[model samples]
Target: MSGEGNEPQAIRKLQPGKLVIASHNAGKVREIAALLEGRGLDVISAGDLDLPEPEETGTTFVMNAELKARAAADLSGLPALADDSGLCVDALGGDPGIFSARWGGENKDFNHAMGLVEDKLAAQPDAPRDAHFVCALALAWPDGHVEWFEGRVDGTLVWPPRGTKGHGYDPVFLPIGYDITFGEMDEPAKNEISHRGDAFRQMVAAVF
Candidate 1:
């Protein structure tokens, strides 16, 4: 922690040990944990540790993810990982990007959020349904070292959202070349090509 105003900091590597997943969302935590299952590190969540969620004042996914990860790491005195992801509809002007969770209202009811997206598209009637999901992952250390990675998956939005397996906007998202929505796919299948999976892969390659 003492090194400051010196040469550029080298990218830190994550050693196998107790790591914090800095998020309260159960679905996201589960997905990340599954991705890390084969790794040797023990994983825990910010929610499990009762760490207060930091306000996401960052404008981009990477910024927000770093914010959460650093906060958790500093508070818990352990290396922490955080993910910020969202659905961006091109027709909606990339809306619900960083505000994806807020679109779900107070309880984070994504069904309602999906409906809102549908309604917005309904009003347009002729706008393209092209959209994408972006995920940003950040790993932070208690000493303030940080790493960031980002991933995106392009797709189209469908009405009458299908399936109930995956969470968030998964039911309405049809990935390119896939007939089934993410919600219709199993965890392993979804993880094979999800935005979060992409980011996680990058982190694992560089860190673990």
Candidate 2:
């Protein structure tokens, strides 16, 4: 909802203090905390504070991330970080863009979601079936300053899930120029090329 700045903006160092990660998902929280830890930042998930899960009504990833970050910053009285991510398929016209999590309904059935994707691509023999995962990270300061960064990895959707290393759509999505799926890749390798990694790098550049 603001102008894009190519040059990195100033981001305050989080002082050897705790920063709340505004997310209910433990996996996401762990990943973010690990990333921030590399910068000498003490990170804690909102769940640790028993904060209520804010409804993600925003239409876009950036909006939703900002909404969560703002809420956490206001409630915790400290800087907050949040991320919104999802898989977007070009063949299906981005059917799962914002609804990637609950694509199978409120239960968040990954099996059902994967099945649906396979079914949609089954009939389209000539379909591109190209897909990518988009991750957007937002940081909100208590004083009302906010910054956002985004990253994506282009890939294609494959039938049948593969490895179990990563979570949520990782098994079926194969990044370009790679033979193995993301879930099959080692943790360090995946972290090096992942969308989250890119966004986190941008965030780090802004801060340190």
Candidate 3:
């Protein structure tokens, strides 16, 4: 998928117009839309367009993000943005790095997945409880040009979970320098320090 010179050219700027968000997860789409608000671009999700969800065959976040972005761009004839994010645990040696969503099973039942996490950690009481959330953002053009950024926010795990504001593992991950889990923090506060937020800001600076 090389562009000119047998290499993909980096997109230095994104013109103000319509863009496709290559994701079907409603929570993810909402968060991304909120981030891009007031940026003079109309954002539409792949789900809204009834775009088929591509299989995420990549083993890493960046590769998966690029795969999704490119797939959406090709289908929509518009610049596309995609994010691949997950929680990595030090104790588990990153068991769920690329499989975070899979851990929730086909139904995407995160409550059961969280319980599994708690159960696994319980068996390793002496192990480190540290963990982090990682997010990789890819911006792809229909011509095969792509730009990407990755960000992480370190934190620790908490048993029994907490709060109900955020979804997925938010209720169990307590960010560094914070007394409350991500589930307890308001959207504005969480966005200011989230891995996705960090990656989005970098992408904005580089391409927008």
What lDDT is reached at residue 43 by model 2?
85
TM-score of each: 0.94, 0.91, 0.94
Q: What value does the lDDT take at residue 9 in candidate 1?
A: 44
Candidate with maximal TM-score: 1
1-208, model 2: which lDDT tens digit per residue? 1213555444454455778899888767877776776576778889998888788899998888899999999999988998999999998888788788878678777778888888888878899979999999888889888888888899998878989877778889999999999889876788788888888887777665
Q: Over the stretch 65-174, how does candidate 3's per-residue lDDT look in tens digits?
A: 99999999999999999999999998998967878888999987888888888889999989999999999988888988888888899999998889998778999999
Minimum summed lDDT over a 10-residue window in model 3 is located at 1-10
lDDT of each prediction vs. the true structure?
0.90, 0.83, 0.88
- Tens-place lDDT digits, model 1, residues 62-145: 889889999999999999999999999999999999999999998999999999999999999999999999999988899888
Please report the TM-score between candidate 2 and the true structure: 0.91
> Whole-model lDDT, candidate 3?
0.88
By TM-score, how accurate is candidate 3?
A: 0.94
Better of 1 and 2 by lDDT: 1
lDDT of 3 at 89: 92
CA RMSD of each candidate after superposition? 3.4, 2.1, 3.0
